[model samples]
Target: MRTAGGVAGAVLVLAGGLLWDIPGLEPAGERMLGIFLAAIILWASEAIPLVATSMGILLAEVLLISSDGLFDVADDVGAVPAADYLAALASPVVVLFIGGFMIAAGATKFDVGRVLSSAILRPLGGRPRPTLLGVMAVTATLGMFMSNTATTATMFAIMLPAITALEDARSRTAMALAIPVAASVGGMMTPVGTPPNAIAIGILADQGIRVTFLDWVLLSLPVAVLLILVAWAFLAWRYLDTSSPLALDADARLDTSRPAVTFYAIAGLAILGWLTEPLHGLSSSTVSLAAVVALLALRVMDGEDVKRLDWPVLWLVAGGIALGRGVGDTGLDSWLIGAVPWGGIPAALVLLAVAAISWGVSNFVSSTAAANLLVPMSIGISISVANSTAEVAVVMALACSLGMCLPVSTPPNAIAHATGLVPTRDMVRIGLLVGGLGVLLLSVAAPLLWSWLGLT
Candidate 1:
């Protein structure tokens, strides 16, 4: 059934491409639209492996959308050269992810993650409610600086023993479910914390709207904190009772050896550098690469540790970046802005509408892909309506970060789903509630916040 639906989506894309010719869109824009649509369907439907689908997008661009494609030429705009699209593979954002992955690998290998998790969680007492909130706090805090997937995995590893010790199955499952949700929400607190945040910043940068690391934190941190608290409440309400006993492994040891200390120092410096990026005038990618080199030089992480870095995620992100570049090269952003009616609608409604669309699409596809497709469209819409692009950009970033309704929605969610502790229907239920609240919060907060920040 899914395969047939994917096929039908592809057919609709081709049919739309051949038939729906808007006033300003040229031949290249039309073709790129079909390619983007088909890619989204394949990505959302799992007709092929997502990494393989990313490869297909690269192939499609090289063979059909590039300037020298054998089949077509640009009718009203300059065709994108192969070099333009191919460079996305090595984009700075990709380097940032690599650096982030290396740091996560180092933390995991040197026992930094385990030690930190133990220190935070061991003091939570053995009661179910306090223990769950403690676990969420630690995981969510780590997520603000590290990849949510790594944070979730590391915290879950450290917590699972305690989770297994719980006397009640309901409480155990709820505790497990909170790890990924907290991880996802925690990532919204910082730009480097997740791929969607970085992707949105990258797109906005191209349009002359520079979002610094601090800028992102100020705009998003409050929202993330509020959501994390709400998630903890939801999990507690559904899974815990006041009297449930939670005994944890008291023997968990914190590694304080010289190597572990050195690892901590390097990791701390890297995070400080990321936080003070504006002062240093260095890109986050450069800071991350430095940390990677330090980890290897100090022997904190070996060549084997490098092998454990998340390469598949980097590839997936690269493909999304490439697709966004294609949309720009073909003038699809402008074409989309022109096609949509944005005249009389209020700016707040525009944000709500865009957020709703992005949130909906993300439940079925990669959030990175949804950010790639929607951020640029939002940017275009902002310019068309003379609205604040910064406002639209925040909504795009937050909406993409908030999607976790399905097992297939994100890697962190997928990992949690694999534990067999969370059912699909339960995730759908809680995810819908949390995601709706997130959209509402953003829609209300963004306009007032951006205005105060003097952005609009």
Candidate 2:
């Protein structure tokens, strides 16, 4: 029923916008609006696959507004080249994420998570509080490089045995809750840490603003660490019993196979390249491709590995890039900026409002989708207000990742809820606290920090 309603509503809106005239909206803008509204409905309701909606956006733009579009338009109306829409798939940001996915896949294949967990957890002395902290720390650290979902799964798989052995229900709940919380927070540490970050960076790159890997890390890592510690303190106080010891027996054996050794070398070099981009004069995307090639050439990863990677994510991001381009080319962005009375509002409040809206919408939809829908508008609004575009973009992106109030909010949250150890009410309570804290910090502290560091 929801899917039917969504599809019906999208069709109606598209037809109405295309056929009927809208005041102050150009013909090209009207066409773009139809596609944009339809995309919102489809993405929000998930009436179809998110990637499907994204692909539709690209195709719709080409057919409706591109220079070579099917329909005729007045000479005064501007149209972007079809190639611009199609080229979104291989955008630098998309390429960067592709590399990130490859590295994550290789790490999972080689059982790097297990080895790291075993080494990191053994030193915490197995006490409940310390064990929980260690688990969260490992999860967050991995999340900085891996997707939050993958990081959560890896940590849970390694720690489930120890968590299950705990007699106290609160202890079990705390341990389970910590993984998603840490994963979500830690995902903000780097541009590749989550899809929203990548989407934001991609959008900014389109506007010719470059956010390097190290620059993103410098901008967000402090806040990530601070949020993780704050969450840990709350969980420990509320659920953990420090008097009890947790028995964690992890598999610490490192894979010594030739392929494993080769992967280690490639992974290390890839990370080094990403961090030293300025010195090497190589874009992160190029370095990632090099690592991917090395892995394949050395047989550490094969075609099958490549096939199993997360292509849908890349497609979804590409769709967003295309959407942003359409919005810009059709003057839809300017129309949107003019539609709102933004001049009367303070820039700081506008930034906070965007962050709040991003957080709220993300609680119901995927973070990537929320970022896809909002980042473009945020960029336009930021520019109109003479505010820092990068600051607004990064805040909205991080805010999207901060939504963890329910199982459906994020894949990591769903994974934790699936364990059945965490009740819905408990999740809401802690999630709201952590998520609210994140928004506050992002809105208040982060801007000052960014300015001090000259990041904005």
Candidate 3:
């Protein structure tokens, strides 16, 4: 099935670029659209390896739209050279994820997650409601700096025993549901917390919009906090019996070995650097890569850890960046600004529409992939509507984090479903509610709150 999809997608792209030409659209724009469609099919369907699809997109751009390509025309001196287009493979955004993966790898290797989980949950006592909240809080906190999928998996390992020993099945279910949802929402708090956020920042950087690590946290932390709170309340009220007490064991042995201590110290310094990026004026990517170096120099992580980094995701992001640039090079973004009906549409509605598209698509595919597809489109649409690209980027990034409706919506969601404690219907019913609340929060919070923060 995937083979068929790949063949069809490739055929469509090659045919559209070589044969079809839309009226009022430049040859480059038409070809880019074709490549864009092919990427959509390849990515959405997972018809091939995502990294291969990304490489395919790069090859397509070089062959179809780069300088002296099939779509090249006179007055196209400004065409992106194949080298410039391929440079996305080493983009700062890609480096950012590289650093993030190193940090996560270190944390996982030293069992930092277990220690953090115990430390946070220890304060909430053994009561059912507090226990639930504590677990969610810890999971979310971990997610703010690591992969939500990893955070969810780690928390599940720690919390499952407590959940299984619960007096009531409803309490077990509530705790189960909270792990993934909290992790997903928690990732919204920071740029390195999730791919969507990183992708958003990377795309915006192409437009000369420099959003610092602190800038992103200032714009998004409030929304993440609010979503976590709402998710907690919803899970408690609907799935858990708050009146009962949960007898959870909150014991964890913190590893205090030399390598572990070094890891923590380096991780702490890295985070401090990220939070104070404006103070030092070092780019987040630089700081992140520095951390990776420190991790290796200090012997906190070895080649095995390096090999375990999420390279495929980095490739996906590189492809997305290349595609966005291609759209700009081909004059599609400018043409889109004129072609789309943005004259009468309000800016807030544009944001909401992008959020809806992101939310809908993420339910079926990886949120990272969803972000890769939608973030670029949102930037183009923002140009059309004269809206704040920063605001649109933040909205779409957060919306991608709302992929909790199904087992496939996100890795964390899949983790929850694999436990057999959460039914598909329950996840859908509550996921819809959580997702609706997310939309509502963005609808009200993004315009008003982001403006107050100068993001608009």
Over 4 Å off, model 3: 68-74
**What TM-score does structure 2 among the candidates reach?**
0.98
Residues 1-456 of candidate 3: C-alpha lDDT, one tens digit per residue: 777967697777767766787776777777887888887888788878777888888998888888855555555523767887888899898898888889988888888888887887787777777777888888988898888988999888888877888777788889999999889988998888988898888888888999988888888778778777887888888889777677666687888899998888999999999899999999999999999999998888989888888888788888888887887777766666677687578877777787888898989988888887778776677777787878887888889888789988999988999998998888897689778778777866667988886766
lDDT by residue (tens digit), candidate 2, 69-174:
8877555254667898899999888888888888899999999999998898888789787778888889998898899999999999998888888888999999
lDDT over C-alpha atoms for residue 129 of model 3: 75
lDDT assessment of candidate 1: 0.78
Ranking of candidates on TM-score, top first: 2, 3, 1
Residue 227: error of model 2 in Å?
A: 0.7
Write down the worst ten-residue block by lDDT for model 1.
69-78
Error of 1 at 355 (Å): 1.2
Best-matching candidate per lDDT = 2
Which lDDT values do the candidates have, in the order given? 0.78, 0.88, 0.83
Which model is ahead, 2 or 3, in terms of lDDT? 2
Position 285, candidate 2: lDDT:
87
Q: How many clashes does the backbone of model 2 have?
A: 0
Clashes of 3: 0
Model 3, position 417, has a per-residue lDDT of: 92
